[model samples]
Target: MFTGIVEELGTVEAVEPLADGGRLTISGPVVTADARHGDSIAVNGVCLTVVEVGEGRFTVDVVSETLRRSSLKGVAPGEKVNLERAMALGDRLGGHIVQGHVDGTAVLRATEPDGLTRFEIPERLSRYLVEKGSITVDGVSLTVVEAGDREFSVALIPTTKQLTTLGVRQPGDEVNIEVDVLAKHLERLARPQLDGLARGE
Candidate 1:
C-alpha cells in the first residue's frame, strides 16, 4: 500500500505498445535509488511492478485492465507523473491509506485562484465521497471540501501545487482517483444489515 504522498515527479521516458498491453519506462531518481525487479511503484496512482531498473529509470508493464481504469491509457512520452514507492511497515502515514488502485478517472472541471479545485466524478463513485473525506487524485492525497452529485472540490495548499503534477493540470484533464477505502468497506459491511432491516428481520 501507499500513502498517496508523492515521493517525486517522474517523467515518462518511453512507451512501447504490445499485443495485450504496453510497457512504460519512467525516470524517477529518488524512487529508483533502491528499486529492484518485482518492486511496486505507484505511477500516477496506478500500482505497477518494476520489471527492470536502470540508471534513474524503471520499466513496468501496464496491462489492459489497468489502462481501462486509469488515465494512463492516454499517457505518452514527456508526461509528468506522480511517483511513490510502497510504504514501509513503520513509516509515518503522512497522507492516508492509498492502495494505489485507481478506482476510476475524474475530469478536472474547474479551478480557482485561491487553491480550490473541482473535479467531475462518475455518479457511481460520488457516493463514496463526503465532506472532508480523503481522495487520491493523480496519486496525491487530498480532502474534499464540497461533495456533489457528480463533482467534488478540494483545496490545495501552495506546497501541494508546487510538489505534484496537480499544479499543472487544466480543465478537462483526466486524473486517476481513488476514494477512501474505509468508506467502501463500511458500505459493504452495512449492506447485509440493511437488507435484513428492509425485510423486517
Candidate 2:
C-alpha cells in the first residue's frame, strides 16, 4: 500500500510494447535507490511491480487491465510521473490510505491562479466524493473543496504544485483518481438498509 504521498517526480525513460502489455522504464533516483525485482512502486497512482532495476531507474510491466484503468495508457517518453514506494510497516501515513488502485480517470477541466483545480469525473463516481473529503489524484492526496454531479475541485498548496506531477497538469489531461476507501466501505455496509428502505419494508 501507499500513502498517496509522492516521493519523487520521475521521468519516463522508455516504453516497450508487448503482445498483452507494455514495459515502462522510469528514472527515479530516490525511489530506485534501494529497489529490487518484485518490489512494488506506485507510478502515477498505479501500483506496478519492479521487473528490473538499473542505475537510477527501474522497469515495470503494465498489463492491459491497468493500462485501461489509468492515465498511464497515455504516458510516453519524457512524461513526468509521481512516484512513491510501498510504505514501510512503521512509516507515517502522511497522506491517507492509498491502495495504489486507480478507481478511474478524471479529466482536468480547469486550474485557477490561486491553485484551485477542478476535474470532471464520471457521474457514477460522484457519490464517493464529498466536500472536504480526501481524494487521490495522480498519486497525490488532496482535499475536495467542492463536489458536483460530474465535477469536483481541490485546492493545491505551493508545495504540491512544485513537488508533484499535478503542478504541470494541463486542461484536457487525464488523471488517475482513487476516492476515499472509507466512503466505499460505508456504502457497502449501508446497502442492505438502503435496499430495504427502497422496498418500503
Instruction: Write model 1 residue lDDT over 1-201, tens digit each, in one string.
Output: 999999999999999998888999999999999999999999999999999999999999999999999999999999999999999999999999999989999999898777689999999999999999899999999999999999999998888888999999999999999999999999999999999999999
Error of 2 at 104 (Å): 0.6
Question: Taking the tens digit of each residue's C-alpha lDDT, what string does model 2 give over 90-145?
Answer: 99999999999899999999987776899999988888999998999999999999
In lDDT terms, how accurate is model 1?
0.95
Candidate 1: worst 10 consecutive residues by lDDT? 109-118
TM-score, one value per model? 0.97, 0.97
TM accuracy, model 1: 0.97
Query: How many clashing pairs in candidate 2?
Result: 0
TM-score, candidate 2, is 0.97
